[model samples]
Target: MSKARTVRFHEYGGPEVLRLEDVEVGQPGPGEVLLRIEAIGLNRAEALFRGGHYIERARSFPARLGLEASGVVEALGDGVDGLAAGQAVSVVPSFSQNDHGVYAERAIVPASSLVPRPEGLGAVEGAAVWMPYVTAYGGLVEVGGMRAGDTVVLTGASSSVGLAAIRTAHRIGAAPLATTRTRAKRDALLKAGAAEVIVTDEEDVAERVRDLTAGRGADLVFDGVAGPGLTDLVRSVAPGGTVLLYGAVSGLPTPYPGFDLGMPAVSLRTYTMPETTRDPERLRRARAFVESGLRTGFFEPAVDRTFTLDEIVAAHRAMEAGHQVGKIVVTVPH
Candidate 1:
């Protein structure tokens, strides 16, 4: 209809800043489409944005939240093509936060960011797939040059993206050695496709890698949690190996110890999914890779919990608690 429920925050703080309100929906402009948002994917970026700690700060009050969502196409703007009303679709959060967001009952999105929802997946699962899969695909395949038999160390193995990396590595025949903060999640990480789980609190990550890989260290490291342990991670890499720094859970600057830099053989690189999406060729390659994985059952978005529109605060709290084994999703009634 004409009015929709939207999530916004007037002030930057904790989850308490979030407010749900009824907003009027305007007609879609050229290259835009109206959607009945069925499910939304909760991302750390949204939390960071809400807290005013992300790279992009809020320019105005009552700022919107969300990027990834799945819905049915309700209407199309002028010049839109190759889509019809009632078609199921997943929307990628590739545009600027200033221009668009999807945490609403109804949303206007550019057709360019919309893709046909893969078969065998519902709206909630559809919303959970894009970011993690794309980030893993781009980092491991495109940037790391991971292949069969390569050894990968995945940090923050409990995050949705980290879990996806484990699955993708297994599908490619690469060894995914994951690290978690405690043994409480050790079993779940192993079940999620990790070849081995290293409990950082109980064991040394670099020593464990040496033991697992026969002293060769990891061929690549998928690092999402870059804190004081970054030094240990740097030491865990094989000579000439690469480390992909994606996120910082401790909110601390990743340290590069002197020994890590002395060796020209090792490297550290930071990656963001938007880097892949911003390039036409890279975007096409990533999309094809993930699409094939989805079709073949090699990759699936595992949702650890689901929340309704009313429980947004609890959802964020759960996410911040770092207890979820997979993605956190928010569902809306039709």
Candidate 2:
């Protein structure tokens, strides 16, 4: 067994319960690969895991928290072919019922979860890009069925996932309209290929969306916000358009009025990115899409800030603050 630093929760509660501890990194078994994690990407899901919000939980006494990482393969277990030791790789963060946490110096991940790291991309950026890109790509291309010249409105556009949607939309020739509360991020969002950036706080989101769409509303609405924001989103989608409800940032219970369902032909559906990760063929396709975009600069991962493993608590706090522009990462010991 090898030793690694990790943040674990003894009892689910707050970030305060997250403690830095030395843990044993066991060797990979058959069809597994050992990754010497170079970086850990932080997500809101981890915070939810710490707070016991997720339905999935660890089976044993102590559970690891992180889900994605980039690293070099230290060893490969039996039956693992075509991969050797000391290869640079990116770990796919999938929905797993059983697996060790990723927020450690080393982890035993399934061979299938391993993907060749994109060339010319740094280890830290690689770790940060996978989940968000897969999430956005799957939602827009796979679920929403967006097409060229389609106007897509993405709520919470400042989120890493939202920005990924922006990039994917533009790359696919869709007109991307983004919503962010802060004015300072507008230019950055626009530069990232958002056709229009609406200040949700200052501007009437529905009105602005209509104005941008020439009063036809958006063809696709990528809404991570729920509750009242859902109502606004319903109003923002053009008739027969699709509203992909992938996340609920507002935590507001969906309040779809009686007439709401009967009034419009809009398709509102819930999407989870991890679903695509579980299907091997789909995962490969998604990875191929993102990898090609990365090589061409159509997609880029932006890290707003980084913290050491010891500062995992601060990292989670920052993510909860909702002001981070892009992904936040935890740099592991090199």
Candidate 3:
């Protein structure tokens, strides 16, 4: 057995509930691999899970806190093949939050969750890229039917997923129109690859979207904040457009708006990373898209901030504040 440091929460609350604790880890069991975590990515899902607002409630306390991580395979369990010790790999969004997480110095993960890090990407970028890029690729490319010359709308445009979607849209020759309620984030969003920035607090989203598309409206919308504002989204989308609703961060009602008389033939599809996670072919394509972008310098991530493992609470607090322009990452020492 060896000692591993991990971040855990005893009860659901705010970021204060997270604590760094030392624990014992045993040898990897069958189908599992022991990983020496080098870097961990912070996601809003962790904050939601910590605050007891995620779609599913935690089964118990001392719960683990993250899923995306870059680590080296330190040991392999019986029956595990195609991976060896000392190989660099990343933990994708394939683990269940109820039973496992990656916020530790060393933890056992399923071998299937491992992906070779993108060539020339460091641990921090490797950990930072997976969840957002895969989710964006899955929702935008696989599920949303994105194509060249299409117009994509992204709300919560400063979040990691939002930023990834913007880059992905631009990479595929689509016009990306992004939205933020704060005026301060507009320029940052544009610099991060958004084709147009919509200030929802000052300008009408539908009006701006109509103007940008020459009155045709957006072809696809990747929305994280789904609520009453969905009315405006419907107004901004073109006929037969697709709104890939992935998150309900607004904490408001998300009722189906089928009764709206002015509604176009928009296809409202709720999405998550599970679509790619469950399908090998989808996963293969998603990784290829991300890798191509990364190799060509089109997938450069905007890192808003970085924190140490001991400062997990502050990292969570920063994430919950909701003003970051890109990814928030936490680094782990060897």
Task: Highest lDDT: give the candidate number.
Answer: 1
For model 2, residues 225-252, the per-residue Cα lDDT tens digits are 7667677788888988988887777766
Give candidate 2 regions above 4 Å deviation.
55-61
What is the per-residue lDDT of model 1 for residues 4-88, given as tens digits with 9 covering 90 to 100?
A: 9998899999998888899888889999999999999998888988998886898888798888999999999999999999999
Q: Looking at model 2, which ten-residue stretch has the lowest summed lDDT?
A: 53-62
Cα RMSD of all models vs. native, in order, equals 1.5, 1.7, 1.4
Clashing pairs in 2: none
On residues 247-278, what C-alpha lDDT tens digit does candidate 3 reach at each position?
Answer: 98787998677568455798887997878876
lDDT for 143 in candidate 2 is 77
Q: What global local distance difference test value does model 2 have?
A: 0.83
lDDT of each: 0.89, 0.83, 0.88
How well does candidate 2 score on lDDT at residue 179? 90
Residue 24 lDDT in candidate 1: 85
When 2 and 3 are scored with TM-score, the better candidate is 3
